[model samples]
Target: MGHRHKNKKLGILIFLVVCVLFLHYCTIHDVVLRHAIYRMLFFLPLVLGSFWFGLKGAIFVSISIIIPYIPYVYHQWNGFYQEFDKFLEAGLFVFMGCLLGYLSEKQQREQEARLKAERLAAIGSAVSQIAHDLKSPLMAIGGFTKQVTRHLSIDHPDRKKLDLVISETFRMEAMVKEMLDFGRPFQLQKTEENLNHLAAECIEISLPFAKSSGVDINTEFDPEITVRPLDSNRMKQVILNLLTNAIQASSSGKIVSVRTKREKQGVALDISDCGCGIKAEDQQKIFEPFFSSKKEGTGLGLAIVKKIVELHGGHIILFSNPEGGVTFSIKLP
Candidate 1:
């Protein structure tokens, strides 16, 4: 897709350059009129560049036009008045490019943002309906399976199978809950709370999972950090999601670390793991809904984490650790 777009741009650029060359070299009895038409024609490429590629592209196209135009202007120079007019025309090309480029870029950004919001809304609605429909049936199945398991002897062959069924049912129920959460709007109940304490609590909650995964979790909390306004429950969800992911990503005996410290903006929380890092291309898409790299992942975990963080007027950043694995950092303001 990118290559196709580039090719189209290149084709248009070549066509525009051809027009300019033809105008410069073509024979004409009316030289003054021809020059006027040639100057006006320059606006086509400038306008296209502004709309197609924004400010830098417009500037680049304007500069490119000037290169071919300089020699023509020198050849057509009649006197001081004509030369000055030509230079003024060139100046206007640049000024127009900048103006059009800025407006075009702003419009493009607004359009993209609107489109994204619409897409997410559609996805959320569909997912909510599906999850709601499945909720009752899933509960019934899990409940009945548990009843069946209770009737079986502890060492019965079917008991183990029923236990697996129950585990899977619980996992599906969690995914459904995630869907509902993503579908609904966030209502933050903010209060002053210590970020360091929050991180510690989340770490403690994740301890069992970390231990099961044979991953050690370490923490560092800065004493200078103070309490800040946050929705404690939602923030805990974010931290726990990230911690769980880190634990899952690490191998046996690997370490996952959580850190909190004072920052100029507010406070920073970091979660790092010693597992295989994400591929470069996939990193940008990780926070996007339903974009997990895991085989059995519902892919809503990080998306929910990002949404909660953003609701608190904070942003999350991700990067690969130099040694191994990925680090997720959240900055609260």
Candidate 2:
């Protein structure tokens, strides 16, 4: 990579010098130089070169083509006209160069985004496989540890430590399973279902937690709308995660709202909480796997939710305002 970079720099430098020399030679032209049309035409290419190679390349090309014309700029009015024409021509070349450069830059960015998405997709598959492998063993381990605890004498010095291990292992196992499901791409288990029904179900399930946290839960759903080809269970999990996170982030007695409605793309689900908003710097990193600002947070919840939404041919956009709140708008097709 280092060598390649050096070579690129060297190549650009050589091209600049050669162009400069060529412009100097053009200035010495006799009959050919006297022709205004030919002289302006010569610099057009240089203008384009500047656009491609940036200001330096254009400058080099201009010197090569325009240096020849500079003397004529004052000598003959016809020559001046020719110079003006050539100046316009060079401007066009530079404009063309800029257009091309802008396109090239835009293309590179799209390619990078696509590649990143592909990489994340591949990693998701691998994570699913690893999570699957760990599930059975984790269950077995938990069961064995429980049995050991029961068989051990009540006064055993290792009891508390062993129980803690067992508890943590179970939690880890659940988290791993959650990741597997989130990253795993499965066939669309599409069925006709009511969007309002799903939202209501999730609310009921999460009510206990809401009561404990003192965060009020509000819901809005269109009952007449029908949405299908969705994994309701997975969608429920995503809602639960988002709402729970909101609760944790909010002060007691705050309000967290979940609203669902039909959009042109599909269904729009907005989950907003009147909690402390995520910091600007942290916002971009929020969806990264295993990243969390909360104490005792696994950090994988949002990552998993993002994957699940994407896999469903949907998108999740997060926004926060100075009102001290975060809103996650999920669009699903």
Candidate 3:
């Protein structure tokens, strides 16, 4: 990564220096009378470098051109009336260049962070699946070891040692299964399905858990709305993930709702939770993998939902409500 960044910086600086030379020579006929275009030229390297190759690239461009600017500066030094305007032009050019470059770098950093989160979420999901799959076998191993221990003589130290081995193996196996589940990728197959039907199924499965947590879920959807292409199982997962998250996030006596409608350009699936909304700083990271509000959450649920939505060529947008809740919008194209 460092080498690639260094190479990108080198390439951009070279390109910017070439631009500066071309601009300098192109205006040679008007050398004695400095032109506004030259001031504009001052930003060519900095702006281009910063916007594409980031801050380091822009700094390199700036350093490369700054030395050349000195000769031009000295040439017009004696013109008393023009000094202020000349300095102002230079300052503004440099400031805007650096500012734009910094902003570009910041955006790239944010995007990179999102990608990292998604990868971790994917890992988490694999872990969850593996953990689920291994529970029965691990249980059997532990149970057999326990049964065998009771049959052995109380003085049999070897029996107890075997039980310890069984116990440790189960623990290691559980961790291995979790790692597998979290590392696997999801496969989505879309078919036309009722949005309301999917939501109902998810709610039914999670209803018992939600009730135990003292949360309520409600849904309103068009009964005969035109069916759109969707992956029923995956959509069920998405609904359950979102609804489960909503229920877990909601405080005692809070309610969550699932609603759908035909909106301009696409169909909309909205899930609103009257729970404590996400913190302002965490809103953007909410859909990122391994990022969660719940203490026990693995954080892959929402990340998988986002990936599924995006795979369907849909948009998932979230925001905090003034009512101290959260509104999630998924628009599928």
Q: How accurate locally, in lDDT, is each candidate?
A: 0.89, 0.73, 0.75
Best by TM-score: 1
Predicted candidate 3 versus true structure: per-residue lDDT over 165-240, tens digit per residue? 7879666664554345346666778898877778778888998998999988888886655778888987876778
Cα RMSD (angstroms) for every candidate in the order listed: 2.8, 6.7, 10.1
Model 1 clashes, total count: 0
From the highest TM-score down, the ranking of the candidates is 1, 2, 3
Question: What is the C-alpha RMSD, rounded to one decimal, of candidate 1?
Answer: 2.8
Model 1, which residues run further than 4 Å from truth?
21-33, 70-88
For residue 284, give model 1's deviation from the true position in Å.
Answer: 2.6
Per-residue lDDT tens digits for candidate 1, residues 155-216, read 99899889999999999999999999998888999999999989899988999998989999
Better of 1 and 3 by lDDT: 1
Q: Candidate 2 — which pairs collide?
A: 23-64, 50-58, 190-229
- Range of the 10 consecutive residues with the lowest summed lDDT in candidate 2: 43-52
